[model samples]
Target: MRTRATVAAVSGALALSALAVPAAQADDSAASYPDVAKVREATSVRAEGEPYALNVSFSNVKIAKAVKVGTTGRVSTAVTYTLTHGTDVNIKAADFVTDAFIYRGSDLRPDHRLFGDKPAKCTATSATTADCKGTIEVYPAAHELLNTDAGTWRAAAEATAFNGQDPAGETFDISKVGYKTQANRGTTLVQRASKLTVDASPEPVKKGKPITVTGKLSRANWDRGTYNGYVEQPVKLQFRKKDGDTYTTLKTVKTNATGNLKTTVTATEDGYFRFTFAGTTTTPAATPAGDYVDVR
Candidate 1:
Protein backbone atom coordinates (compact mmCIF):
# COMPACT_ATOMS: atom_id res chain seq x y z
CA MET A 1 0.00 0.00 0.00
CA ARG A 2 1.09 3.62 -0.73
CA THR A 3 0.61 6.94 1.04
CA ARG A 4 0.04 10.52 -0.08
CA ALA A 5 1.86 13.70 0.89
CA THR A 6 -0.31 16.39 2.32
CA VAL A 7 0.26 19.94 3.58
CA ALA A 8 0.51 20.73 7.28
CA ALA A 9 3.42 22.94 8.38
CA VAL A 10 5.27 21.62 11.41
CA SER A 11 8.53 22.51 13.27
CA GLY A 12 12.24 21.92 12.39
CA ALA A 13 14.70 22.90 9.60
CA LEU A 14 12.40 21.35 7.04
CA ALA A 15 9.67 23.18 8.93
CA LEU A 16 7.49 23.68 5.88
CA SER A 17 4.75 21.04 5.81
CA ALA A 18 3.85 17.51 6.83
CA LEU A 19 1.72 14.66 5.52
CA ALA A 20 -1.78 14.92 6.93
CA VAL A 21 -4.11 11.94 7.17
CA PRO A 22 -7.51 11.40 8.69
CA ALA A 23 -7.47 11.84 12.48
CA ALA A 24 -9.15 8.49 12.89
CA GLN A 25 -6.30 6.84 10.98
CA ALA A 26 -3.38 8.25 12.97
CA ASP A 27 -2.04 4.80 13.74
CA ASP A 28 -2.77 3.40 10.31
CA SER A 29 0.57 3.15 8.54
CA ALA A 30 -0.71 3.23 4.98
CA ALA A 31 -2.75 6.33 5.72
CA SER A 32 0.01 8.34 7.44
CA TYR A 33 3.00 9.15 5.22
CA PRO A 34 3.84 9.56 1.53
CA ASP A 35 5.20 6.65 -0.50
CA VAL A 36 3.42 5.93 -3.80
CA ALA A 37 0.56 6.43 -6.28
CA LYS A 38 -1.01 9.41 -4.52
CA VAL A 39 -3.48 11.54 -6.42
CA ARG A 40 -7.17 12.24 -6.67
CA GLU A 41 -9.60 13.45 -9.35
CA ALA A 42 -7.97 16.82 -9.85
CA THR A 43 -5.32 17.92 -12.32
CA SER A 44 -3.28 16.27 -15.05
CA VAL A 45 -0.46 15.50 -12.59
CA ARG A 46 -3.18 14.06 -10.45
CA ALA A 47 -4.22 12.26 -13.63
CA GLU A 48 -1.10 10.11 -13.59
CA GLY A 49 -1.26 10.03 -9.80
CA GLU A 50 2.51 9.71 -9.83
CA PRO A 51 4.84 12.30 -8.45
CA TYR A 52 7.00 13.64 -11.26
CA ALA A 53 10.63 12.94 -10.58
CA LEU A 54 12.73 15.95 -9.69
CA ASN A 55 16.44 16.32 -10.44
CA VAL A 56 17.76 15.30 -7.06
CA SER A 57 19.77 12.49 -5.49
CA PHE A 58 20.61 11.43 -1.93
CA SER A 59 24.02 10.07 -0.98
CA ASN A 60 26.06 9.33 2.14
CA VAL A 61 22.83 8.85 4.02
CA LYS A 62 23.41 7.92 7.66
CA ILE A 63 20.78 7.03 10.19
CA ALA A 64 21.36 6.76 13.94
CA LYS A 65 23.41 3.73 14.96
CA ALA A 66 20.93 2.70 17.63
CA VAL A 67 17.16 3.01 17.28
CA LYS A 68 16.03 1.67 20.67
CA VAL A 69 12.41 2.54 20.92
CA GLY A 70 10.50 2.05 24.14
CA THR A 71 6.85 2.19 25.13
CA THR A 72 4.90 5.41 25.88
CA GLY A 73 6.86 8.24 24.19
CA ARG A 74 8.28 8.97 20.75
CA VAL A 75 11.77 7.82 19.90
CA SER A 76 13.59 10.18 17.55
CA THR A 77 16.76 9.34 15.66
CA ALA A 78 18.97 11.86 13.94
CA VAL A 79 19.48 11.53 10.19
CA THR A 80 22.17 13.23 8.13
CA TYR A 81 22.75 13.01 4.40
CA THR A 82 24.09 14.71 1.31
CA LEU A 83 21.71 15.94 -1.36
CA THR A 84 22.84 16.70 -4.90
CA HIS A 85 20.65 18.40 -7.41
CA GLY A 86 20.84 20.03 -10.82
CA THR A 87 21.91 23.69 -10.90
CA ASP A 88 18.47 24.59 -12.18
CA VAL A 89 17.01 23.29 -8.96
CA ASN A 90 16.96 26.00 -6.27
CA ILE A 91 17.11 24.10 -3.01
CA LYS A 92 17.19 27.40 -1.19
CA ALA A 93 13.85 28.32 -2.67
CA ALA A 94 11.30 29.27 -0.05
CA ASP A 95 9.01 26.42 -0.98
CA PHE A 96 11.67 23.75 -1.49
CA VAL A 97 11.36 21.05 1.14
CA THR A 98 13.17 17.73 1.56
CA ASP A 99 13.54 15.16 4.36
CA ALA A 100 14.44 11.54 5.05
CA PHE A 101 12.55 8.78 6.85
CA ILE A 102 12.56 5.05 7.61
CA TYR A 103 10.13 2.35 6.54
CA ARG A 104 9.58 -1.34 7.19
CA GLY A 105 9.09 -3.72 4.27
CA SER A 106 10.92 -4.56 1.04
CA ASP A 107 9.88 -1.58 -1.08
CA LEU A 108 9.44 2.18 -1.19
CA ARG A 109 5.69 1.85 -1.26
CA PRO A 110 5.51 1.74 2.51
CA ASP A 111 2.87 -0.05 4.52
CA HIS A 112 4.47 1.22 7.73
CA ARG A 113 6.81 4.19 8.22
CA LEU A 114 8.46 6.48 10.82
CA PHE A 115 8.65 10.19 10.04
CA GLY A 116 10.15 13.18 11.83
CA ASP A 117 7.69 15.30 13.67
CA LYS A 118 9.68 18.23 12.25
CA PRO A 119 11.00 18.79 8.74
CA ALA A 120 14.70 18.64 7.88
CA LYS A 121 16.79 21.70 7.23
CA CYS A 122 19.41 21.86 4.49
CA THR A 123 22.55 23.94 3.99
CA ALA A 124 23.99 24.54 0.54
CA THR A 125 27.71 23.85 0.12
CA SER A 126 27.32 24.78 -3.53
CA ALA A 127 24.59 25.54 -6.05
CA THR A 128 24.30 21.83 -6.81
CA THR A 129 25.30 20.25 -3.52
CA ALA A 130 23.93 20.47 0.02
CA ASP A 131 24.09 18.84 3.45
CA CYS A 132 20.80 17.89 5.05
CA LYS A 133 19.83 16.78 8.53
CA GLY A 134 16.60 15.66 10.12
CA THR A 135 15.02 13.27 12.59
CA ILE A 136 12.57 10.34 12.36
CA GLU A 137 10.36 9.79 15.36
CA VAL A 138 8.83 6.40 16.09
CA TYR A 139 5.79 5.85 18.25
CA PRO A 140 5.81 2.08 18.51
CA ALA A 141 2.21 1.63 19.49
CA ALA A 142 0.92 4.47 17.37
CA HIS A 143 2.46 3.12 14.17
CA GLU A 144 1.49 -0.46 14.98
CA LEU A 145 5.04 -1.78 15.16
CA LEU A 146 5.01 -5.51 15.61
CA ASN A 147 7.52 -7.94 17.04
CA THR A 148 8.23 -8.91 13.41
CA ASP A 149 8.86 -5.31 12.43
CA ALA A 150 12.07 -5.10 14.39
CA GLY A 151 15.70 -5.71 13.30
CA THR A 152 16.19 -3.77 10.04
CA TRP A 153 14.32 -1.05 8.19
CA ARG A 154 14.99 0.69 4.87
CA ALA A 155 15.88 4.39 4.59
CA ALA A 156 14.30 6.74 2.03
CA ALA A 157 13.58 10.39 1.38
CA GLU A 158 11.21 12.75 -0.43
CA ALA A 159 11.36 16.32 -1.73
CA THR A 160 8.65 18.68 -2.87
CA ALA A 161 8.71 22.13 -4.47
CA PHE A 162 5.52 24.07 -4.66
CA ASN A 163 7.13 26.16 -7.39
CA GLY A 164 5.29 29.29 -6.33
CA GLN A 165 2.04 27.34 -6.41
CA ASP A 166 -0.14 26.94 -3.37
CA PRO A 167 -0.82 23.26 -2.65
CA ALA A 168 -3.99 24.23 -0.81
CA GLY A 169 -5.16 26.60 -3.47
CA GLU A 170 -8.56 25.94 -5.08
CA THR A 171 -6.88 26.07 -8.51
CA PHE A 172 -3.93 23.99 -7.35
CA ASP A 173 -2.50 21.47 -9.76
CA ILE A 174 -0.38 18.68 -8.35
CA SER A 175 1.00 18.29 -11.87
CA LYS A 176 2.58 21.72 -11.57
CA VAL A 177 4.36 20.72 -8.36
CA GLY A 178 7.88 19.33 -8.43
CA TYR A 179 8.50 16.14 -6.47
CA LYS A 180 11.18 13.49 -6.11
CA THR A 181 11.87 10.44 -3.96
CA GLN A 182 14.86 8.16 -3.36
CA ALA A 183 14.57 4.70 -1.81
CA ASN A 184 16.92 2.16 -0.27
CA ARG A 185 19.55 4.76 0.39
CA GLY A 186 20.58 2.51 3.23
CA THR A 187 19.27 0.37 6.09
CA THR A 188 19.12 0.67 9.88
CA LEU A 189 18.04 -1.53 12.76
CA VAL A 190 14.74 -0.84 14.51
CA GLN A 191 15.25 -2.60 17.81
CA ARG A 192 13.03 -2.77 20.85
CA ALA A 193 14.50 -2.16 24.32
CA SER A 194 15.16 -5.28 26.36
CA LYS A 195 16.24 -5.69 30.02
CA LEU A 196 17.72 -8.64 31.90
CA THR A 197 18.53 -8.93 35.58
CA VAL A 198 20.44 -11.51 37.63
CA ASP A 199 20.92 -12.35 41.29
CA ALA A 200 22.69 -15.25 42.98
CA SER A 201 21.79 -16.00 46.60
CA PRO A 202 23.99 -17.32 49.42
CA GLU A 203 26.94 -15.36 48.11
CA PRO A 204 29.28 -16.66 50.80
CA VAL A 205 28.72 -20.39 50.60
CA LYS A 206 30.85 -23.44 51.16
CA LYS A 207 33.04 -24.36 48.21
CA GLY A 208 31.12 -27.59 47.60
CA LYS A 209 27.67 -26.24 48.52
CA PRO A 210 24.78 -25.39 46.21
CA ILE A 211 24.18 -21.82 45.03
CA THR A 212 20.88 -20.65 43.58
CA VAL A 213 20.87 -18.26 40.60
CA THR A 214 17.83 -16.27 39.60
CA GLY A 215 16.92 -13.62 37.02
CA LYS A 216 14.13 -11.92 35.14
CA LEU A 217 13.76 -11.28 31.42
CA SER A 218 11.72 -8.42 30.14
CA ARG A 219 11.20 -6.21 27.08
CA ALA A 220 9.63 -2.90 26.29
CA ASN A 221 5.87 -2.80 26.05
CA TRP A 222 5.33 0.08 23.69
CA ASP A 223 1.70 0.41 24.66
CA ARG A 224 2.23 0.44 28.42
CA GLY A 225 5.62 2.08 29.02
CA THR A 226 6.73 -0.87 31.11
CA TYR A 227 9.25 -3.64 30.87
CA ASN A 228 6.91 -6.57 31.15
CA GLY A 229 7.95 -10.16 31.62
CA TYR A 230 8.95 -12.12 28.54
CA VAL A 231 7.32 -15.39 29.47
CA GLU A 232 8.58 -18.79 28.37
CA GLN A 233 11.76 -17.38 26.85
CA PRO A 234 15.07 -19.15 27.15
CA VAL A 235 17.77 -17.35 29.11
CA LYS A 236 21.35 -18.43 29.59
CA LEU A 237 22.91 -18.63 33.03
CA GLN A 238 26.52 -17.59 32.60
CA PHE A 239 29.37 -17.45 35.10
CA ARG A 240 32.86 -15.94 34.95
CA LYS A 241 35.59 -16.56 37.49
CA LYS A 242 36.99 -13.41 39.08
CA ASP A 243 40.36 -14.38 37.64
CA GLY A 244 38.95 -15.36 34.25
CA ASP A 245 38.16 -13.01 31.40
CA THR A 246 35.34 -14.91 29.79
CA TYR A 247 31.95 -16.06 30.93
CA THR A 248 30.96 -19.71 30.49
CA THR A 249 27.35 -20.70 30.15
CA LEU A 250 26.55 -22.87 33.12
CA LYS A 251 23.05 -23.74 32.07
CA THR A 252 20.03 -22.64 30.05
CA VAL A 253 16.82 -21.92 31.83
CA LYS A 254 13.43 -20.87 30.49
CA THR A 255 11.50 -18.01 31.95
CA ASN A 256 8.50 -18.96 34.04
CA ALA A 257 4.98 -17.75 33.34
CA THR A 258 6.03 -14.36 34.75
CA GLY A 259 9.46 -14.25 33.04
CA ASN A 260 11.35 -15.34 36.09
CA LEU A 261 14.38 -17.64 35.89
CA LYS A 262 15.83 -19.81 38.63
CA THR A 263 18.33 -22.64 38.75
CA THR A 264 20.91 -24.25 41.03
CA VAL A 265 24.67 -24.45 40.63
CA THR A 266 27.39 -25.90 42.87
CA ALA A 267 29.83 -23.38 44.30
CA THR A 268 33.38 -24.09 43.22
CA GLU A 269 35.22 -20.81 42.80
CA ASP A 270 34.62 -17.13 43.45
CA GLY A 271 32.94 -15.63 40.40
CA TYR A 272 30.26 -13.40 38.95
CA PHE A 273 26.99 -14.55 37.47
CA ARG A 274 24.58 -13.00 34.93
CA PHE A 275 21.70 -13.78 32.61
CA THR A 276 21.76 -13.37 28.85
CA PHE A 277 18.83 -13.29 26.48
CA ALA A 278 19.54 -13.94 22.79
CA GLY A 279 16.54 -11.87 21.84
CA THR A 280 13.76 -12.16 19.24
CA THR A 281 13.01 -10.43 15.97
CA THR A 282 11.50 -7.43 17.74
CA THR A 283 13.94 -7.19 20.65
CA PRO A 284 17.72 -6.79 20.92
CA ALA A 285 19.98 -9.06 22.89
CA ALA A 286 20.48 -8.14 26.56
CA THR A 287 23.48 -8.83 28.81
CA PRO A 288 23.38 -6.92 32.04
CA ALA A 289 26.02 -6.49 34.70
CA GLY A 290 26.90 -9.57 36.66
CA ASP A 291 26.32 -10.20 40.38
CA TYR A 292 29.36 -11.33 42.26
CA VAL A 293 29.44 -14.25 44.71
CA ASP A 294 32.03 -15.56 47.13
CA VAL A 295 32.91 -19.22 47.62
CA ARG A 296 34.39 -20.08 50.99
Candidate 2:
Protein backbone atom coordinates (compact mmCIF):
# COMPACT_ATOMS: atom_id res chain seq x y z
CA MET A 1 0.00 0.00 0.00
CA ARG A 2 2.93 2.31 -0.46
CA THR A 3 2.99 4.54 -3.54
CA ARG A 4 -0.68 4.10 -4.23
CA ALA A 5 -2.18 2.88 -0.95
CA THR A 6 0.09 4.66 1.50
CA VAL A 7 -2.01 7.19 3.40
CA ALA A 8 -0.73 10.72 3.13
CA ALA A 9 -2.00 12.44 6.30
CA VAL A 10 -2.34 15.98 5.11
CA SER A 11 -5.21 18.27 4.31
CA GLY A 12 -8.59 16.74 3.46
CA ALA A 13 -7.61 16.37 -0.17
CA LEU A 14 -5.66 14.08 -2.55
CA ALA A 15 -5.15 11.32 0.04
CA LEU A 16 -7.99 9.32 -1.44
CA SER A 17 -5.12 7.71 -3.30
CA ALA A 18 -4.77 5.38 -0.31
CA LEU A 19 -7.89 3.44 -1.23
CA ALA A 20 -8.36 0.42 -3.53
CA VAL A 21 -7.57 2.05 -6.85
CA PRO A 22 -6.21 -0.74 -9.03
CA ALA A 23 -3.39 -0.29 -11.53
CA ALA A 24 -5.58 -0.19 -14.69
CA GLN A 25 -8.19 2.01 -13.08
CA ALA A 26 -5.50 4.12 -11.44
CA ASP A 27 -3.85 4.78 -14.80
CA ASP A 28 -7.16 5.71 -16.42
CA SER A 29 -8.14 7.89 -13.49
CA ALA A 30 -4.86 9.72 -13.70
CA ALA A 31 -5.65 10.74 -17.29
CA SER A 32 -9.35 11.48 -16.69
CA TYR A 33 -8.76 13.26 -13.40
CA PRO A 34 -11.25 12.18 -10.73
CA ASP A 35 -13.55 14.73 -9.11
CA VAL A 36 -12.55 16.53 -5.88
CA ALA A 37 -15.48 15.07 -3.92
CA LYS A 38 -14.35 11.55 -4.84
CA VAL A 39 -10.85 12.36 -3.54
CA ARG A 40 -12.06 13.51 -0.11
CA GLU A 41 -14.36 10.52 0.20
CA ALA A 42 -11.46 8.11 -0.32
CA THR A 43 -9.24 9.63 2.36
CA SER A 44 -12.07 9.87 4.87
CA VAL A 45 -11.90 6.12 5.48
CA ARG A 46 -8.90 6.44 7.78
CA ALA A 47 -9.25 10.14 8.62
CA GLU A 48 -12.71 10.17 10.16
CA GLY A 49 -13.11 6.36 9.78
CA GLU A 50 -16.35 4.35 9.46
CA PRO A 51 -18.61 3.84 12.44
CA TYR A 52 -19.60 0.34 11.34
CA ALA A 53 -16.26 -1.01 10.11
CA LEU A 54 -14.70 -4.38 10.92
CA ASN A 55 -13.29 -5.18 14.36
CA VAL A 56 -9.47 -5.39 14.25
CA SER A 57 -6.86 -4.42 16.78
CA PHE A 58 -3.15 -3.72 16.42
CA SER A 59 -1.18 -4.97 19.40
CA ASN A 60 2.45 -5.36 20.43
CA VAL A 61 3.35 -2.82 17.80
CA LYS A 62 7.14 -2.77 18.14
CA ILE A 63 8.99 -0.02 16.27
CA ALA A 64 12.52 1.11 17.02
CA LYS A 65 12.90 3.26 20.12
CA ALA A 66 14.40 6.02 18.00
CA VAL A 67 14.84 6.62 14.26
CA LYS A 68 17.88 8.67 13.36
CA VAL A 69 17.87 10.46 9.99
CA GLY A 70 20.92 12.05 8.46
CA THR A 71 21.21 14.48 5.57
CA THR A 72 21.10 13.24 1.96
CA GLY A 73 19.78 9.71 2.44
CA ARG A 74 16.94 7.52 3.64
CA VAL A 75 16.46 6.04 7.09
CA SER A 76 14.20 3.12 7.83
CA THR A 77 13.48 0.73 10.71
CA ALA A 78 11.73 -2.64 10.86
CA VAL A 79 8.32 -2.84 12.52
CA THR A 80 6.37 -5.86 13.68
CA TYR A 81 2.94 -6.21 15.25
CA THR A 82 0.13 -8.64 15.93
CA LEU A 83 -3.12 -8.13 14.06
CA THR A 84 -6.33 -9.59 15.43
CA HIS A 85 -9.60 -9.44 13.55
CA GLY A 86 -12.95 -11.16 13.49
CA THR A 87 -13.05 -14.61 11.91
CA ASP A 88 -15.26 -13.21 9.22
CA VAL A 89 -12.51 -10.92 7.98
CA ASN A 90 -10.12 -12.26 5.27
CA ILE A 91 -6.64 -10.91 5.96
CA LYS A 92 -5.20 -13.03 3.16
CA ALA A 93 -7.29 -11.26 0.55
CA ALA A 94 -5.15 -9.81 -2.22
CA ASP A 95 -6.52 -6.34 -1.47
CA PHE A 96 -6.00 -6.58 2.29
CA VAL A 97 -3.31 -4.17 3.46
CA THR A 98 -2.52 -2.92 6.94
CA ASP A 99 0.38 -0.92 8.35
CA ALA A 100 1.55 1.37 11.14
CA PHE A 101 2.87 4.93 10.83
CA ILE A 102 4.32 7.74 12.96
CA TYR A 103 3.20 11.36 13.08
CA ARG A 104 3.86 14.47 15.10
CA GLY A 105 1.97 17.59 16.17
CA SER A 106 -1.40 17.99 14.44
CA ASP A 107 -2.74 15.03 12.47
CA LEU A 108 -3.31 17.25 9.46
CA ARG A 109 0.40 18.02 9.04
CA PRO A 110 1.83 15.98 6.17
CA ASP A 111 5.46 16.76 6.96
CA HIS A 112 4.96 15.41 10.46
CA ARG A 113 3.87 11.93 9.35
CA LEU A 114 5.92 9.02 7.95
CA PHE A 115 5.04 5.66 6.33
CA GLY A 116 6.66 2.67 4.70
CA ASP A 117 7.82 2.79 1.11
CA LYS A 118 6.40 -0.68 0.52
CA PRO A 119 3.37 -2.61 1.73
CA ALA A 120 3.68 -4.70 4.86
CA LYS A 121 4.03 -8.50 4.72
CA CYS A 122 1.76 -10.55 6.97
CA THR A 123 1.38 -14.23 7.80
CA ALA A 124 -1.62 -15.68 9.53
CA THR A 125 -1.02 -17.61 12.73
CA SER A 126 -4.66 -18.41 13.36
CA ALA A 127 -8.04 -17.80 11.79
CA THR A 128 -8.31 -14.46 13.59
CA THR A 129 -4.71 -13.45 14.12
CA ALA A 130 -1.78 -12.58 11.89
CA ASP A 131 1.79 -11.40 12.43
CA CYS A 132 2.69 -8.41 10.25
CA LYS A 133 6.05 -6.97 9.37
CA GLY A 134 6.91 -3.65 7.74
CA THR A 135 9.32 -0.72 7.71
CA ILE A 136 8.91 3.03 8.27
CA GLU A 137 10.95 5.14 5.86
CA VAL A 138 12.15 8.73 6.07
CA TYR A 139 13.80 10.91 3.41
CA PRO A 140 15.89 13.82 4.50
CA ALA A 141 16.44 15.06 0.97
CA ALA A 142 12.70 15.43 0.54
CA HIS A 143 12.79 18.31 2.98
CA GLU A 144 9.89 16.76 4.86
CA LEU A 145 11.74 17.24 8.14
CA LEU A 146 13.44 20.07 10.00
CA ASN A 147 15.51 20.47 13.13
CA THR A 148 12.39 21.29 15.09
CA ASP A 149 10.72 18.17 13.75
CA ALA A 150 12.96 15.96 15.86
CA GLY A 151 11.60 14.49 19.10
CA THR A 152 8.71 12.28 20.07
CA TRP A 153 6.04 11.33 17.53
CA ARG A 154 2.77 9.43 18.01
CA ALA A 155 2.15 6.09 16.29
CA ALA A 156 -1.02 4.73 14.68
CA ALA A 157 -2.06 1.53 12.96
CA GLU A 158 -4.64 1.21 10.20
CA ALA A 159 -5.94 -1.60 8.03
CA THR A 160 -7.97 -1.40 4.86
CA ALA A 161 -9.45 -4.50 3.31
CA PHE A 162 -10.94 -3.20 0.10
CA ASN A 163 -12.91 -6.43 -0.26
CA GLY A 164 -13.28 -5.73 -3.95
CA GLN A 165 -14.55 -2.18 -3.54
CA ASP A 166 -13.55 0.92 -5.47
CA PRO A 167 -12.27 3.26 -2.76
CA ALA A 168 -12.03 6.30 -5.04
CA GLY A 169 -15.46 6.01 -6.58
CA GLU A 170 -17.71 9.03 -6.34
CA THR A 171 -20.48 6.92 -4.85
CA PHE A 172 -18.10 4.77 -2.81
CA ASP A 173 -19.65 3.34 0.33
CA ILE A 174 -17.20 3.13 3.22
CA SER A 175 -19.62 1.15 5.35
CA LYS A 176 -19.16 -1.78 2.99
CA VAL A 177 -15.36 -1.87 3.49
CA GLY A 178 -13.42 -3.58 6.26
CA TYR A 179 -11.40 -0.71 7.69
CA LYS A 180 -9.94 -0.20 11.16
CA THR A 181 -7.64 2.33 12.79
CA GLN A 182 -6.07 2.46 16.25
CA ALA A 183 -4.43 5.71 17.26
CA ASN A 184 -1.86 6.50 19.95
CA ARG A 185 -0.22 3.13 19.52
CA GLY A 186 2.72 4.61 21.40
CA THR A 187 5.64 7.05 20.85
CA THR A 188 9.00 7.04 19.05
CA LEU A 189 11.84 9.47 18.68
CA VAL A 190 12.97 11.06 15.39
CA GLN A 191 16.38 12.63 15.79
CA ARG A 192 18.93 14.40 13.58
CA ALA A 193 22.39 12.82 13.05
CA SER A 194 25.32 14.69 14.48
CA LYS A 195 29.05 14.95 13.58
CA LEU A 196 32.17 16.29 15.28
CA THR A 197 35.80 16.80 14.21
CA VAL A 198 39.01 17.79 15.88
CA ASP A 199 42.43 18.92 14.52
CA ALA A 200 45.44 19.63 16.72
CA SER A 201 48.14 20.98 14.40
CA PRO A 202 51.92 21.65 14.67
CA GLU A 203 52.78 17.98 15.20
CA PRO A 204 56.19 18.33 16.88
CA VAL A 205 56.07 21.22 19.34
CA LYS A 206 58.50 22.71 21.89
CA LYS A 207 57.68 22.16 25.56
CA GLY A 208 55.66 24.94 27.26
CA LYS A 209 54.94 26.47 23.82
CA PRO A 210 51.40 27.54 22.95
CA ILE A 211 49.56 25.04 20.72
CA THR A 212 46.33 25.53 18.77
CA VAL A 213 43.36 23.14 18.74
CA THR A 214 40.54 23.44 16.17
CA GLY A 215 37.43 21.56 15.16
CA LYS A 216 33.78 21.90 14.10
CA LEU A 217 30.39 20.72 15.28
CA SER A 218 27.74 19.86 12.71
CA ARG A 219 24.29 18.28 12.47
CA ALA A 220 22.07 17.06 9.70
CA ASN A 221 20.12 19.73 7.85
CA TRP A 222 17.13 18.04 6.33
CA ASP A 223 16.16 21.21 4.51
CA ARG A 224 19.43 21.31 2.60
CA GLY A 225 20.28 17.62 2.43
CA THR A 226 23.63 18.34 4.09
CA TYR A 227 25.30 18.90 7.43
CA ASN A 228 25.34 22.41 8.79
CA GLY A 229 27.32 24.03 11.54
CA TYR A 230 25.62 24.15 14.91
CA VAL A 231 26.57 27.52 16.22
CA GLU A 232 26.71 28.97 19.74
CA GLN A 233 26.75 25.50 21.29
CA PRO A 234 28.98 24.50 24.16
CA VAL A 235 31.70 21.97 23.31
CA LYS A 236 34.20 20.45 25.70
CA LEU A 237 37.94 20.64 25.03
CA GLN A 238 39.58 17.55 26.42
CA PHE A 239 43.18 16.33 26.54
CA ARG A 240 44.77 12.95 27.25
CA LYS A 241 48.42 12.22 28.01
CA LYS A 242 50.20 9.92 25.58
CA ASP A 243 50.21 7.17 28.18
CA GLY A 244 46.83 7.96 29.72
CA ASP A 245 43.76 5.77 29.29
CA THR A 246 41.21 8.58 29.70
CA TYR A 247 40.80 12.13 28.66
CA THR A 248 40.47 15.04 31.10
CA THR A 249 38.28 18.06 30.39
CA LEU A 250 40.50 21.11 30.09
CA LYS A 251 37.91 23.85 29.46
CA THR A 252 34.49 24.29 27.87
CA VAL A 253 34.36 26.29 24.66
CA LYS A 254 31.46 27.41 22.55
CA THR A 255 31.27 27.06 18.78
CA ASN A 256 31.56 30.20 16.71
CA ALA A 257 28.87 31.48 14.42
CA THR A 258 29.95 28.95 11.79
CA GLY A 259 30.40 26.10 14.27
CA ASN A 260 34.19 26.28 14.14
CA LEU A 261 36.25 25.74 17.29
CA LYS A 262 39.66 27.12 18.11
CA THR A 263 41.54 27.23 21.39
CA THR A 264 45.13 27.56 22.66
CA VAL A 265 46.74 25.33 25.26
CA THR A 266 50.31 25.28 26.51
CA ALA A 267 52.26 22.34 25.13
CA THR A 268 53.47 20.12 27.96
CA GLU A 269 53.54 16.37 27.45
CA ASP A 270 52.65 14.55 24.22
CA GLY A 271 48.96 13.70 24.10
CA TYR A 272 45.67 13.75 22.17
CA PHE A 273 43.16 16.62 21.93
CA ARG A 274 39.45 16.27 21.23
CA PHE A 275 36.15 18.18 21.29
CA THR A 276 32.77 16.86 22.37
CA PHE A 277 29.21 18.07 22.28
CA ALA A 278 26.48 16.94 24.67
CA GLY A 279 23.91 17.25 21.88
CA THR A 280 20.44 18.71 22.01
CA THR A 281 16.95 17.27 22.00
CA THR A 282 16.84 17.16 18.22
CA THR A 283 20.45 16.11 17.45
CA PRO A 284 22.42 13.11 18.67
CA ALA A 285 25.73 13.44 20.47
CA ALA A 286 28.99 12.93 18.50
CA THR A 287 32.55 12.16 19.50
CA PRO A 288 35.01 12.00 16.65
CA ALA A 289 38.49 10.48 16.58
CA GLY A 290 40.96 12.48 18.64
CA ASP A 291 43.83 14.34 17.01
CA TYR A 292 47.31 13.82 18.35
CA VAL A 293 50.28 16.24 18.66
CA ASP A 294 53.80 15.53 19.82
CA VAL A 295 55.62 17.74 22.36
CA ARG A 296 59.40 18.11 22.49
What are the models' TM-scores? 0.76, 0.78
Model 2: per-residue Cα lDDT over 1-296, one tens digit each: 12212234324233323433233223333211123223324555344554256679998888887788897667888888899999878876655667777877655433355766554678889989988887788767766677778888878777766565565567665556665667778788888888899999788999999989999998888767788899999999999999999999999999999989999999999999999898776777888877889999
Which regions of candidate 2 are displaced past 4 Å?
Answer: 1-51, 107-111, 168-172
The local distance difference test score of each candidate is 0.70, 0.72
Candidate number with greatest TM-score = 2
* TM match of model 2 to true structure: 0.78
Give per-residue CA lDDT, model 1, range 100-192, as digits (tens).
Answer: 888765453354566676557788898798898888877665534666666788898777655655544577556666677777988888877
lDDT of 1 at 270: 96
Per-candidate clashes, comma-separated: 3, 0
TM-score of 1: 0.76
8, model 2: CA deviation in Å?
9.7
lDDT of 2 at 76: 85
Worst ten-residue run, lDDT, model 2? 28-37
